[model samples]
Target: MQSAIETARKQLPKIRIELVDCYTGSAAQALIALTAARAVKLGDNLNQIIPKVNKVIPEAEITLVLDTLKYLERGGRAPKIGAWATSLLKIKPVVTNRMGHAHFLGMARSRTQGIERMIRTMRGKIGLNRVSAIIIHSELETEAKELEHRLRSEFNCNETYVTEISAVVAVHLGPGAIGIAFLPS
Candidate 1:
């Protein structure tokens, strides 16, 4: 079935959309994330850095090719304890922005479990009922569809879609990455 982003793009007017840089890997995520910024270094240099960081944040609003935390573990950014624990349990961590950096949200033991986690996160933050539009991107359509399904089933967001990740974006996510980006209402 078509996704909410697909339908929205096909049926509604375009907003002069532009596909910019994509971010992946925890180091890059740590460098680019703006979700939960603490000024530890920044705070000390607040008077100096705040202005500089602000100028960078909007442009740094990177399209994170969100990935399963395993890749991050292999990259050596994730804590060994969490990685080992998840591996022992066959769990996948749901990653998202933390202080504008990439961090773990929760664990998903399976694909369906991941979708529920994703949908719950989106719904809680943006509200399934009032979602403005969605950008459903993935390394493969089959997996991407699950995200579309969640949006459609929960929010009537039939406009969702599946699109290929760019080469630059792929560099970080590698293959088989599925990313869903939503604009805040």
Candidate 2:
């Protein structure tokens, strides 16, 4: 991004271009972008928008539950033995992105359990604060909606969205992956 910004600057020296790293991917990244967009729509200039976006970076959190670990193993993100064991045990792997890295939270025997774990983690982080959230899934819209409903009832929601994971993200997470990205206000 910096390289591209530099190249563009060479041609349009007076124009301003900046990149903000959300340090997370998927719905978390989208939430940051939405915050910036909302600021812009409210007539904030580049300077003001940048600060608002920066403030949201640390506040944003993402948690995901994968139906299987085979995709991670295939992508070289996990060990083959671990994926094999998860499959053999029918465990759903729960993970969260923190400081730009995916961290394993725990394992669940079912999707319901995984979703419950996600909500519990969010509650621990957010308490009673009002939250803005995005629920993302890979070929699992029904599950995503259910998660969204749960979130709305469990927290004071400022806004909520449901979306399918992008193909690039889906490639790594694989099908049947569901997750949430949230920011507490």
Give the Cα-based TM-score of candidate 1 against the true structure. Answer: 0.52
lDDT for each residue of candidate 1 in 1-185, tens digit (9 for 90 to 100): 24755666677665332222323333223332332254444454445445544443342212333445455556666777775776678665666653356656677767566656766666666564444333344456777776666666777453444566666545545455555554332
RMSD of each: 14.2, 1.4
Per-candidate TM-score against the hidden true structure: 0.52, 0.94
What are the lDDT figures for the candidates, one per model? Answer: 0.50, 0.91
CA error at residue 75 for candidate 2, angstroms: 1.5
Local accuracy of candidate 2 as per-residue lDDT tens digits, 74-122: 9999889979988899999999997598899999999889999999999
Candidate No. with top lDDT: 2
- For model 1, the stretches where C-alpha displacement exceeds 4 angstroms are 1-68, 132-138, 156-159, 167-176
